[model samples]
Target: MKKTSLGIFTVASLAIACQSGNQAGYDASGLDSTALASITEEAYKSYVMKLSSDEFLGRKPFTKGDTLTVNYIQEQFKQLGLSPGNGDSYFQEVPLVEIDTKPVSPTLTFTGANGSLTVKHLDDFVVSSKRLQNDIKINQSELVFVGFGIVAPEFNWNDYANIDVKGKTVVAMVSDPGRYDKSLFKADTMTYYGRWDYKYEEAARQGAAGILLIHETGAASYGWNVVRTGWAGPQLAMVSDDKGASKTEFEGWISQETATKLLNLAGLPKDIQEQAKKTGFKPVPMPVTTTFALKNEFRESKTNNVIAKIEGSKRPDEVIIYTAHWDHLGIGEPVNGDSIYNGAIDNASGVAALFELAKAFKAAKVKPERTIVFIALTSEEEGLLGSEYYTQHPIYPLKKTVANLNIDAFSPLGATKDVSVVGFGQTEIEDYVIKSAAKFNRTVKGERNPTTGGFYRSDHFNFVKNGVPGLFMGSGSDFMEQDSTVINKRKAALGGRYHTVRDEVTEDWSFDGILADIKLFFDIGYTMSMEKSFPNFKPASEFKELGDKRLAK
Candidate 1:
């Protein structure tokens, strides 16, 4: 792919200062209207178009696309007059290992009392191994059905409590019991235990040889195609001291059809899912066994988190962060003769938003009282590896970091009457979000579908996990110019193209929506930067105690 330079654009070159104070027809809450106006549709479109173009090769890390992408962002920060965020360097090195796993035999056969069944790879299932070893094999391992595969002491639930899963293959359901039984867990508000990654971690902790998640569309919040494509290539993970030997031997997913057949073969009831939802449900040892083997090819390399900052005039040590991931799926399985997964919305648009926000801060009439940091993270799609690395090894002190505002995959469907804050009531940052939205006559709301675990699915969750108050906003459903039916059709169409080659910018997209969102984000970050006190997690939030401890001094 040929790389092209979009040229440098400085704060002075924006010429936004000339049209200050309500000239752009937006009366924000006394913020520098000049800075707000600087975030223009032209600039946003240019950045998105350039970053998501075929020339960028989907911006995957450890590839030629990565070199071009990071260099481009560094150049932009330099032109925008922002200083390097990490001790005179715009890049923070993140060591990682990429593993490409291939099955020794493309079929997994399960033998039970009824009969034997064989499933084809990618069609009925998809699997991968995290271990650094070149070969991994599980021979005729006993299969145990562990409901949800979660062990939450606070919830008084343990799926692996009575049974010894050592050296056995455990099959679990995605999501949690609360998703089906309102009486258990958070009741549709998916907890961390509901996430697939958590399930794999718990299985490995319990000494399971292998784990296969039964994929149901609603339970996984995505289709089989997502699993088939997402797990098809090289998987990236942060470099481990033990080289991932501690993780499960292998983790994979089986389609609902395959799972049903497996259950029937074991003479288990068809209503097993309903039974699994009840409390005190025990792990069912299927009278079946299967073999799993994979050959892995891995390499070690270092990717980058592009960081830039604008120092505060007064309290330079205190900081506020704005983050957006820049990496995508790169060239992958071809769809409609196209292999490049140009993640225009998933998140070249987000990186574009990061630059626009940086431009706003730089164009402010007065320097902020707290430093503002912009991070273009890498490898968020590959299980948030970039963020995992950053939070573990922070460039700034975690305690001094006031707040994190994250942008990911902004809608291009024009303006709406409301804006959504993921995990709405968790932190006082919601107060800031509400006040900011009010300035534009927009209402604030929680995520429309909490069962999808949207809160823990992004880069900001890493910050939240470390006791930082993180804000993640979404474009609300109340479209200003369209009815719900019309908007649903458009949204559904967009969802179909998500994480695929067709996610590139199209003719139907409008900048009015994302531009409004960028404005709301600017207000929140700007206000927090000027505040004296740190934001706190709400008492009901799980991270409240962590937040309290961090701010105790």
Candidate 2:
């Protein structure tokens, strides 16, 4: 059972504050206003329960669940009087290819001066390929331990210095060297370089045949099971123009235990990772060679992005997008005899919020000057594929799009005194968030765990990459309850259920927090839509240049 916080402010106060907030640009006495006011706890609860129900079959893309999920969202949009976000249809077809890879017997074998060692799949290591090939084989590729596998000229760090890894396999650590040496990167905060995506990208750029990241739970901020499950299922990717030719043949992870044993076999120091964290560290050539054969069964399918729009009264072409991924792990390995991975809090809540927000807008007496687009994206759990595709083939030009506000897994642990803004300080949108949140007697805080790279993990990152400001906010732990212990325990419990089958809707969930967050987001987006100018990335942000270039175009 979940614990409820008995706070200084009662639930009645929270409801009154949220409903009585200044509806500045909004029509004060319209159906929309009434709808917004009627976003009651019971209504929100019903939406979540139905969306996350087992009948949806976990809402995985390319399955019956996808059909039901998209149909339901479309029906809701129609009921809300929202027109198709696309030209004439509520659906945007995203072409995708699913690769179901099963490693051959004796999948990974390492041979070194210490003799041969075999690692079991999903036990000692988890491997997957981005390349679109039926059969992939690495024949005794030389293994070289290349620190963090980072090549950042700005940081003056090159792990591949004085080494040629072309046609060879590179074994690298999960995060950047700065994870250990605070002064190296962004101190303890993770940069894009620390992301596994960057490691694989850097390896592919250097012509490496394969890349293996050594997993450390603390450094990666997730357990090995996450890695195993995420990569084990039918991996989906946007059907690349080059068919993933630019990607490395293999990208995988090895458990810390497996890594230590591999290091011993290679006659390398077990403390090599420690040594690599220092300044001016060079690549280490391990005496190990690896061989692996992977077979992939491929299927091509198309998924639909449920997009609904509220066109602006004036600048109809100008758009503000609200995004959330509708896809989850699907029916996967059962946990506790339950095979369905009902992504209740993982996203059903966000989609439910999407519906509620749309209703609120539709019922408004007056619409904003800019278009508001609500997009229920697909294949986010697969790698933000839906949003990525939208950016590539945007319904509206990126230059005309003001900003993106994304809602993913919201906290159900009751109302809080603050809201955590991921990627805080990167854009001016945060200022709007602060102003809107303050009306509720709440504050805005930067991400509490920056090391997890939470900012880039969600659908908003795709927008940020394309030079549009995006905001991904979550519930803050600073609850109304004086004691922090209650909130901390709640957070810990949520973390355990994340990405697991146990992430189902529970009766104990308090919609007060979710309702507050949704209202804040609605306010921010409404404010942006009413404004005359677009929100730009801060000058210090790496994405600022891209935004400027896109806007100029």
Candidate 3:
């Protein structure tokens, strides 16, 4: 027998208590308060510990770790007595291609009037080929400086205007023009146009043979070392039906220093970035050409997105999804004698929260009116691939999904007086977050740095892109009973470990904050589950029209 807030109760007794409401009490939203006890720190810690342990090998997809990770999640769901979410199965197969692209030479050389300058691999530049082919080559493709390489007509911005990049290698700056100029685009806040992935997509759309984004620490929100570590190994992509023919032959990054050398070699001004930031900046065709080739070793493999659900008793067609990616960096380049990028805080924490949420929902005395779907997604580290695939081929109709609540990385710092909502004020779904936070005397706030484009970096953005309102919450900054120095040091320490082999669980971690967040998440999801109204995207939101179209369908 399990001991809940209502004292001793077997599984049978708990179900009866749910129905009779004798020992268990209900909140203002009619959610069973007793169920909240199920989201304990012990359970969360256990899941995080087990999942992030060395045996999991960082939980990367297409590895033995992937098989073990998915099996653990599925077995947990089964033990919780939840039905499979994907109609008779707990797993949704996501096909992916692992492409290991290696350059033919140790250095990529640029030939110009000034002479030839070579950039070393993994030091000055890093490149990858998304195309599903054994061999790829770019033979002295003309080099053109294409500013930001964005094409957003709505924002009255077109970097590609009056320029033809056909068969040429376009050298663009990472991030958008708005990053430098507050008057342009979204100002300090980064839109999708600012993402490197978007830059590559735009370049491919313009028929560019290759695209190299100049990496600036401030604009890219990360150092060159981070980029080198991420792109040095095999890259994963969705196994496209067209074999990625629509993409550019190669996409890469060149360090800011290397970019400067190339610009100086071409006799271009060092103030090129300043000129590009201004409106109506045109592309400059540099008198330089480079030959690049990649020998790609690729293999097609499948991974699973572990999904399970608690079906609604009344309106079963409608759903409220809770998602978190289960995959991480896997075994990567050795750092400090450690090879596994465990990703304990990056996502294992989120998956643990997912499990706790499922358990909490099951503990409730009353069943939700809307189906509650728990998806332990995969490959979020490699460009939010799992969620993107799910949105593209939804098991439930897009029109029927109420909203997406996503958890990516949870803070290990202690409890705070507020909760951070990424991409704040985009939808009415935030109202639920606000309401839930108020119960615990915590205020709602936006992320500390909106310019990093944190919202677009997560899996929830995929749901928002597909017309479903989505919400992503983060642990608040204002730690209770902790001084600013201690907090800053703690935060900085964790920041240093992010995405590295050192992302393992530390002994000083506190789950008090996480437990509080879990309750708030449960409250929001529970409220949405019982509500008949759908949350709509705000008019200023880029996804507004998509939301309207979804509901119209």
Candidate 4:
């Protein structure tokens, strides 16, 4: 009943077409081109609209929304006849601890030679404890400005080189030194050292009691609202043996205005922050101490990762994975009279594409030679938790996983002439992407903004960390009906709506772009699934050694 370029062909008609020396028709393996073309815009839009509806409550983890989302995806998988990806189960339990902390009245107090200064919460600063404890406090913790708080030997940079930050609170800059000097580290592109996650990890390693990063828009690539939303409600993290005690007692951010006022109070020039950008800049011990305490409320909970598989007909043990996070910011601080962060484009779109891809593979007359596993992950907004857990406790052997193809936050601007491959040159999977896109007269291009550190920001990074080659692609800007200016405007508009209530499904949404992108993924996965060769990380990749090690094992 479906129309395609190759025309509507049933099984019998496809067989007849194949008999006429038509290589594009049904193959001996029973794969019909018509079925591949059956992936339609209507099917894709239906899934997105349903998943991003208000009834789902934004799909945040450990909420009613989470329950509704997991159940829906599981039912879809069951209906599609996909076997449980986990051992006899479609769900993989991820143990998590949720911490809800509220600052005591008079949240932050700083005392030094200039006198005492009091800062309010939410407006000037926000703080919380990751440690699982009834009471947490930093009493007169000596405050020190530790530049970017980076200590990368590769770049010959260390902000805490001569100073001992033990038992002190380090007020650090948001990004790395390279942000100022392009020659420092990876030029303008942000390395692992530039991420807030890396900042917290480094601070913990230095035995700091607390760390507050000065929020800056350009460097952080987001506004304060994102930070506030992340700090609000119940914060989820994988339960650790130490209950996160090894990390700082409290980690947070202060507005640039607040940081300036605090610096002035510490008898340091407001403009002294620029000094920290230089390589030889030493940690400046602010002539002040900060005091704060948090009364904590904690709950231990679990979330499920929905995984389904279509086993290979030939190499059953080998796998090609497709992943997308289903979780988004749930009911939080309201914006424009809307509390739900629908995340329609942020992730609901990606999940819908996952379902469509699964449907396509299932509908194919011939099964892939290597297994295909589709995973709808949870808590990606929190920090790639589901994928990290799965990697640690893998359902299939890591060495046998030929490649990971991740879809996240797709564009709705219709089909384009190119696709953006995040971390394009890091692995050999780019070859497959290029080949697949070329089939439709589309080209493969690298991410337009590598400085955002986008390669490390998504779920695929987890797979790459475990030595499996992973590819994450998004729709490009060269729309068929629109020029670069219109495409750029659409992308800019989407950027403004990211992580906000305005991210809900809109009337003008188009699925032509998504349909093309999904078909590209199908082609890439199919090629990987049937090939005898395994893709490896390129020589320049930091993950190359890990991939080689895993393969060797």
Report the alpha-carbon TM-score of model 4 versus the true structure.
Answer: 0.92
Worst 10 residues of 3 by lDDT: 1-10
Per-residue lDDT of model 1, residues 1-553, tens digit only: 1011101111221232233334443332355777889999999999999999999998999999999999999999999899999998999999999999999998999999889989999999999988999999889999999989999999999988889999999999999888888888988889999999999999999999999999999988899988998998899987888989899999999999999999899889999867888899889999999988899999999999999999988999999999999999999989879999999999999999999999998887776899999999999999988888999999999899999999999998768989988887789888777766756667777899899888899999999999998988978978897567766766776768778899888876879989999988998898788779999899989999989988985
Instruction: Report the Cα lDDT for residue 338, model 3.
Output: 91
Model 4 ranges off by over 4 Å: 1-32, 269-271, 483-495
Candidate 2 ranges beyond 4 A from true positions: 1-35, 483-493
Best by lDDT: 1
Any idea how many clashes model 4 has? 2
> What do the candidate models score in CA lDDT, each in turn?
0.88, 0.84, 0.87, 0.84
lDDT of residue 358 for candidate 2: 84
lDDT of 3 by residue, 375-460 (tens): 99999988899999999989988899999999988988878888999998688787777666655667777888877888799999
Better of 1 and 2 by TM-score: 1
lDDT of 2 by residue, 157-198 (tens): 999999999999999998887678788887777888989888
The whole-model C-alpha lDDT of candidate 3 against the native structure comes to 0.87
Better of 2 and 3 by lDDT: 3
Going through the candidates in order, what is the number of backbone clashes in each?
0, 2, 1, 2
User: If scored against the real structure, what TM-score would every candidate get?
Assistant: 0.94, 0.93, 0.94, 0.92
Ranking by lDDT: 1, 3, 2, 4
TM-score of 3: 0.94
lDDT: the better of candidates 1 and 4: 1
